[model samples]
Target: MNSPYSQKIVQPDISLTICGYSKVLEIVSNKWTGLVIYAMEDGIIRYGDMRRRIEGISKKMLTQTLRQLERDGLVNRKITPAVPPIVEYSLSGLGESLLVPMKALNQWTKENYSQVELARENYDRINSGE
Candidate 1:
């Protein structure tokens, strides 16, 4: 019962391509990465405001994530000369392209989270001999 998607995945080149592309997955694999991306979805936002929007993330973590995103060309950072030297962040064109798929994943998570939780619980129970 191999569908087109599965069949394509079976191809050697396609499998290698996916392996190569997994780096992109690692870039966004952290919990904070997606939240940071979503926080900037509307438009440019100040660093302080972004920090506030993404609760529980430490300043160090935010700074690290933003730096990584900028380095990857997925986010743009701007600095304004001021008393405090204001810093702003926004999604780059690449980041904007990533948002469409991210939003789809978010929606999928919202829709299927219960099923995921159930599966996790079942797995844990079975593994624990409960």
Candidate 2:
């Protein structure tokens, strides 16, 4: 029996052949992207501050993620004219717009995570053959 969920997975129309939504997800749905966005939610943050705030992120990965976000126009990188050159990052208007939905999703996950954990526990017990 085909479920409604399965039926809903139709291909995009010709006009949407490029799958713009998918492209956006490709940019934002990575493991570190959301965390980086959340870290900048307060305001502009320096590179060192962001790296310290987001635990478990390597210097290389954070650098790569920041570059990708800047390339996608979701983040703004500013370089100060000081001797050592201070670099800071902040969300662009587009990034702020994207945050609304991402915040909603974050709230939903917090609310439902316990239920999801319980479901996983039940599934594991059922399949344990014990």
Candidate 3:
């Protein structure tokens, strides 16, 4: 049976313009990246240090996010040729600019968590008839 939703997917046309929300979302949408950036805010400069602070983040994901941030000119990676290797990651000037806004976001989330929890409870109660 033919269904209206079963049509073959086609790429939608996009103009050569970027939206502000898209730009912000692109930078901050990665779950691990935001935590990494927040961790770096408090002088976290070493690879192992960041990994430890952001518990459960896999090495591969951390590496990939760091690379992406570096490519986006948000973070700087320094390598020291010690006996094995000493590498440090820190925010670049451009990256530091984001800290204020990110911190605001963090603060807002903290402030609104109680309201969010209440909303969720109300939603669950209404939906479950309990």
Candidate with maximal lDDT: 1
How accurate locally is residue 76 in candidate 1, as Cα lDDT from 0 to 100? Answer: 99
Per-residue lDDT of candidate 3, residues 1-130 (tens digit): 9996589758544433556767877888999989989878865389998999898899999999999999999899999999779999999988999998998988999999899999999999889964
Model 1 lDDT tens row, 1-130: 8576664454355453467568778888988999999999999999999999998999999999999999999999999999999999999999999999889999999999999999999999889964
**Candidate 2 C-alpha lDDT tens digits along 84-125:** 899999999998998998998889999999999999999999
Query: Each candidate's TM vs. the true structure?
Result: 0.83, 0.82, 0.81
Q: What is the lDDT of residue 39 in candidate 3?
A: 76
Worst 10 residues of 1 by lDDT: 8-17
Off by over 4 Å in 2: 1-21
lDDT of 1 at 8: 44
What TM-score quantifies how close candidate 1 is to the native fold?
0.83
Model 3, residue 73: C-alpha shift (Å):
0.7
How well does model 2 score by local distance difference test? 0.91
